[model samples]
Target: MLRAEWTKIRTLRSTVITLALVFVIAVGLGVVSLTSVRIAFERGLPLVREDFEPVTDAMVSVLYAQLALAAFGVLVICGEYGGGMIRTSLTAVPSRGRFYAAKIAVCASVALVLSYATVFATFLTAHWTLGKYGPSWSSDGAIRVVLGTPLYLTLLCLFALGVGTLLRHTALALTVVLSFVFVLSPLATVVPGLREVAHYLPDQAGSSIVKVGQQADPVIGPWAGLLVLAAWTAVSLIGGYLVLRGRDA
Candidate 1:
């Protein structure tokens, strides 16, 4: 079953396009953002800004880029439904749990690999470029950014998959996931009380796991933040499994 699904995913143009975009956008954003930061620093513009930090440039890039990744993750499942492939898939593998598990495994594996690649590229690019300025690659947060960035991104992809499975509609799932990642959390920055709660938001928590910078208003530490995000993923996936079993395929 796993092998079959793997072959199906490989043959699909959407899978290739989605993963390619993941690589391009993830690496491209990091490279561009770091280069711009370096240029600004060279021109005597201060590197430290309101929310930007030079030490975690790579981390920031991955965090932002994961939004794109999350969308791809959602599409991976929802696209099947959109194209009427779910029925065929279920027919081939009658045990819905097995099919879902296979997808989860494939998505998690691919996400980890791609996420690591993006993080590695970002680290190498930013480290070399930033060295020309002032902040050395050997700085305090450098290692964390290199190591934690991929883990954060991988979890986010899983989170999005869980949501996509539960929602089953690409458009609806995309709307919910985007609202959580972009609009809701950022919007929470304004409301004083919500700002604290917002840090516990799925994307917010995941971002904190990858954050190498010192935040002015950190609600939770890295591990705890990741736990929060993981909890969200876990609940959604479990709920999705139940829904898949209960529903008529």
Candidate 2:
């Protein structure tokens, strides 16, 4: 089942284009950020030393890349539904549980590989561009962000997939997922009383894993934040599976 799902995923043109965008957007934006830092140094712009975090700056491109990843996840399942292949897939598998599990696993595996590679490339590009200003592999918590960030992205793919499965419409699913992650999450952060609550939003909580130091140390601890995101992922997946079983498709 895994192999079959993987074969389908690999054959997807979006898989290639989306992964390419994930890499290019992340690395390109990271390089641009480093270039700005270079400009600042050259101009002696009096940037606050205490406010800077190389690791965070280096991975800044990931913020945008994550949107692409989520969209790719949405397309994975929604494409099948949109094109009416889902019925055929369901007929072939019989057990919706097995089908859903295989779909989730394939999407996650693909996201994990692409996200890790993109993040690593972004980090390396930043290191090269920033030279001594950037975090090295030996830097405290550098490895953690490098490793944990990809995990966050992988979970996000699953979350988006679950939402896509439940919604079963590409446009509707993309709108909900993107708004939930980018719009509502950030809105929750700045609205006084909701600030603390926003810390637990799926993306906000997961973002803690990528914070390495005082620059953006999260209210929640790294693993705990990831657990929060994982819990949300679980709820979405369970709900999606239940809906899938109940539906005619």
Candidate 3:
């Protein structure tokens, strides 16, 4: 089952496009971002307290990685439905549990590899470009994004997969997942009273774990933010599983 799912994912054009964006946007934007920061410092412009995560600033490409990875996750299963392949997949597997498990496993494995490679590329590139000005690998934000970004991205893929499974339509799933990753979360953050509420939503909560020093949201710490993301993934997966079992393909 795992093998079958892997085969399906690797063959898809959306898989290739989305994963490539993960690498390109991460590395490409990291170079642009860090170099621009370096230029700003050379010109005597000062970084404000609110945006003072040097390590995260260097690896700023992650801002875009979030969406690409989430889109990849949405495509993994939702594409099958879009192309009228889910019914055949269910017929072949016979057990929705095994099928869902296999799909999740394949998606997780691929996400792990891709996320690590993308983060590492951005990390190495930032340090190389910034030289002595670069933050050490052991620094708090450096460690968090180096370690946590990949995990953050991987979890996002799974969360997206779960949402995709529940929705079972490519357009709708993409709309919802992209909003979750991009639009809605940030909107909630900037709103007057919902700042605290944004702290717990999946993207904002998960992102807190990646920020340097994380001064804004006093409530959640790095690991706690990760747990919040994990909790969201768990609920999404469970709900998706229930929906998968109760409905027709």
Q: What are the TM-scores, per candidate, against the unseen true structure?
A: 0.92, 0.95, 0.93
Residue-level lDDT of model 1, residues 1-249, one tens digit each, is 778767766788877787777777766776777788778867878754766655565556667677778887887788888898889989998998888899888888888888888878766766776666434557666666567767778788888888898889988998998898779998997788787789888888867755665652366877787788889888888887888888876
Q: Compare candidates 2 and 3 on lDDT and give the better one.
A: 2
What ordering of candidates by lDDT runs from best to worst?
Answer: 2, 3, 1
Model 1 stretches with alpha carbons more than 4 Å out: 46-52, 134-137
Error of 3 at 125 (Å): 0.8
Task: Pick the winner on TM-score between candidates 1 and 2.
Answer: 2
- lDDT for every model? 0.77, 0.87, 0.83
| Global Cα RMSD, each model | 2.0, 1.5, 1.8
lDDT tens digits by residue: candidate 3, 1-249: 989998898888889888899899988888887887777667777753455666767656876877888989889988988899999999999999999999999999999998888888888888887766666787666776788878888988899999998998878988998887578888987899987888889987887766776443587877788899999999999999999999987
| Backbone atom clashes (below 3 Å) for every candidate | 0, 0, 0
The TM-score that candidate 3 achieves is 0.93
Candidate 2's C-alpha runs over 4 A off are 46-50
Top candidate (TM-score): 2
Candidate achieving the largest lDDT: 2
Whole-model lDDT, candidate 2?
Answer: 0.87
